[model samples]
Target: MSKSESALALPSRRALFKSRLNNRTLMRQVIARQESRRSRNLSDAAELPPFAVRVLTRMGFGPRRTELAPQSAPNPNQVFSDQFQRSPLLGKDDVAYFESLGRNDDERLERYVDEQLYGNLPDPEWEQRKAAYPASFDTLDEPLSTTYSERECQGFSNYVVPQRQVERAAFARACYSRRQLLELIVDFWHNHFNVFSGGDEDIYVSWAHWDRAVIREHAFGNFHDLVQATAKHPAMLHYLDNYANEAGGFNENYARELFELHTLGAINYLGNTSPLDAPLLAANPYSGLNDPLLDALNISDPARDIQSHYTDNDVYEAAKALTGWRYDDEDIRDENNVCTSGGTGAFFVNEADHDSGGKVILSGGLQNIPADRGALEDGEVAIKLAVYHPGTARYIALKLCQRLIADEPPESVIQAAADTFYANRTEPDQIARTLRTILLSDEFKDPANWGKKIKRPFEYAVSAMRAAQCDYTWRFDDRDTDNFLRTYEGTGQRLYWWRTPDGYADDRAAWMGSTTLVQNWRTVDWLLDENDDSDADRVMRIIDTTLENFPGNPTPRELVAFWCHWILGFTPSGGWVGDVGTYYAHEPTALGRACMQFITQQDFNGEEDSPPFPADQQIPREELRNDDWPNRWHRRLRGMVKLILWSPNFMQR
Candidate 1:
């Protein structure tokens, strides 16, 4: 067998099932190791790192190496050049680009924020890379039924081709795109207005449209526009059972989540109370003004009073208003039993199924829908009322802050972002302005707040690949890529696979568990491994840490230092650098011995370490001075890279 084949082999089904028996013991060991790392980071917290490092890792999927200018440049005495030479792993071009924006950290941060928010930076490389994956982008305009039939005719038994293609493209963008802020915001919105792309055949087949048209288009656009688009999309309609909602048989699934998760959030949820009992607020100026519905209701000064909090009665009324909103499919019909729309995959209101009776919503408010209004008007008004609520602004702002800053961000920043969101409700760049408020706030640049957040599984995986300069092809049929994704699922944060509408938890407590930690470590190994059974030249290697790229023969200590600086971006504490370097000097063959030593010696509940290095068989560093050392230690060096990625320093933002 080839080296890749041996390294990438999978266990049998029975063996995999039997492995579950040991999960309890494995969980304990992972917990202990995490505690040790946490303590060490707290102890070593003194001086703050550079702002560039923080921005690259937290805002984007970490940094990649950049081409350096010649030492004989016009301005060779520039201080950045000296810093770049000292830390060769740092992306010199990236840092220089940020530095050119302003003279200091705060100024540079503001410039960078505006550039990203306005999308002033063009990434031709990402566009060119994305162009290669036509299959991922071309099916967005196709109907779900047509796409499903075509896939079946093409010998695909499953109807998930579009979803898989989208997943591949998303991964590629996260790893390669220079529009880093846009990509991150897109991810945040996808999680916020999440739909299970793999749940149903229609959703699976039309997943491309949901991603491209609904989410990406409105990622930095108005929040109200995004919510309305999500409410009408077929993926969300099917996922939340809104397609079946009608006049006689109302489905409250979409309505409940719209209020609880999407719009006003649970913070404004006053359960099982009369709508009239909720606090009264001033009416939204944009809604209920000169409306035919409210006019027909014969309510004087209908826009005078509005309810602050929503009750169960309000949800029921919202469901009534939202009835008959569905995509253009074969089943849509009018009261005359004639087909109104079909096979278009566009949203349409079925008048036959719509509830047009007179109803009062937000009860003290004059936002009432009179009987016999137009088909789509009621739903539009209802959505406007929810989107314009004060609670919606605060809820969405808090979520954005939680994603970009800390889990529990400072109230000052949240209020500032919320004000921006509310004030710019009618602006095209509402979301962009809100993000600017958060990113440029003093709370964001505070030294004490740095590294307070932990990287999620998606962030960790993409950042590791990016830091190592992984050559990702994003081809759906590649064996190694397939293996990497399957292993990534174990981390429990698979993209678009979140079961509930609330989405994946963003706080540290949700992801700090032992299962998540161990699974993330396993994903690191998968990334470092070579493609199984393929020739070195034929295979698209994920990572290449072999010394063949080095200019000259280097000692074990130097090798350790290079990777540590490359992956962690800053020097780590807790004797990690010295311990790993010493272990490499003593045993060159067992490159990850020191890492395993740290894991085990820290009282990690006696878990058995892998690729076992014998304690008695130590090879001195001088023994590896031959010309063939690079080829001999290529795989072992990858093991060391895995160790660095698994370290706690890499986990922090």
Candidate 2:
């Protein structure tokens, strides 16, 4: 048979086994030789390759990858010779603009909160304040203690304060950051203990509570403690309607998501294994060996399968358990003629609303659990029961490792991390130790894994701004108008603009389409020249300041080529340059000389002194002209930049 046909043939089972054995034998020999060499009391020290370092950084948190070519390494000032930091991309002035906006946001949030607490405008210029920070919708003649309006105070109560603080805390940690790993942990925990900002009044306070009590306190702590805090937090209680859980009404939203999303992945028949196969069938979905007994718990269905089984009843039970715990409304008044009911911030468990009969919780923790602690004190016992489960440890460890390493982390790595979690059950902060072990492991910084994650819209936008040094702000007076747009953060045009609860999709295929490609090209145009209102010399200086060690090649032809290289990071091959040149070859280099020939025929922008097209070239005047000369010329430049941005090289760290 021909070599190709032989290669395509499937190997026999014996041949496959032989191949695996050979690979294992080779690896073992390499390790044994390395160990023997090290026995002379010498350390086997090897610096990570440059590409590996870049990959490691991207794996943790996406950053712009510099040129990985060894000869293109950056100099002492920390810039590459071939690259110019200056771009029609972001510039130095943009950083100042964004930072200024950040400061203004801080001031606005402070004033808005102060005004809400004291029952009066915090500033004497309150009307001007109304003008400056107009509410999205008009308030009633007087505002109610509880409001669902898109008003600034309530909006502040919802999206702004907690987000700003979380963002600021995260940004601060990013700036001059020492604890690199903590930032990754915060991201993991934030997604893990997600709170829908638009949930309710209590969520305003509870949002902050989850961040402070659950995510932040134990972000690097033990998985057990993190889950416990999340289960008990007032924000989670209200967000998931857990506060409303009671005997007659069980809201299993918390319970269901806690398992399917937060803890153990749902059990199902493997795609390869037939469901009818008894040997392949695992444990019952409803009950892991450790599920709690609900006889004393008084659930809607006492014998209900509250285990891993995802029945319609499970969601109901999950939602019901979260009932009755609600926010203290500032407007609520008691019969004694006083507004005494709503204390506002704390998690209040009302006895009248609680299901007091005993409930057994079935969890994987059955081996060591102290049994259902009998009729519990409202939410406290339930919270503890949810948090202290063994499944929480494994679930949390898996998530942390996934974020730091890969989504499908090695079973050994997860087990090691989970072991750390189990060992430190009492001190919930042990989760961080497990994470550190994972991140610092050889598997995490692997070359094959570099630049593997598709950047989410927000990460894409932020990383682009940081990379290009773009200096723009979304700080217009009517801020809520911009929040939706801000979701697209990298490329100016908003991304998918998703309205669903799933947040944004996390795959590259979602962004790789013709429309997005056109949008990306448009952004490159805007970054390069459309936003070029500032002086050209000033713009160049901003480029010099931001891009390090540019000008890798000093020749005239190479200078233009090098600019493309720094901006695009890859050298254009002959075929590529020929493609761009094919469009422009018909045109003369000089406008003055060319305009002499075609000045009367060319149209110009309305400005009286606006220049006309080059005389020697035929410019398409508003006919769908992708193929015509001038448009093609524009496309050549814009295309190179766009290709750079869209190319896999630009997609890396």
User: Pick by TM-score: which candidate is best?
Assistant: 1
List model 2 lDDT by residue over 1-653, tens digit each.
42212211222324323332222222233234323332221101211223323432443333322322333322334322212222222122222211222134333223222222222212222233234433321221222222222322343544344433333333323321223345445655665566665465455434444555567567665555566566666666666666666667566667666655565434311223221231311332222223244223333232332233223332333344444665444444458765433344544556566554433344221211132232234344344444444555576667666555554667877877777765565553466456555655556656554444444434443444334433333222324224424433444223212233233434444554434433443343344333233433211122332224332312112222333334432342331122222322222211111112121122222333333333223333221112243223322222223333333334433
> Residue 327 of candidate 2: its Cα lDDT?
44
Q: lDDT for every model?
A: 0.66, 0.39
Q: TM-score of predicted model 1?
A: 0.79
User: What's the TM for model 2?
Assistant: 0.54
Estimate, for each residue in 426-500, the C-alpha lDDT of model 1 and write its tens digit. Answer: 788999999988998988888667766878999988888777766656656667668778999999998899988
Models 1 onward score TM values of 0.79, 0.54
Worst 10 residues of 2 by lDDT: 39-48
Q: After superposition, how far is residue 151 of candidate 1 from its true place, in Å?
A: 5.5
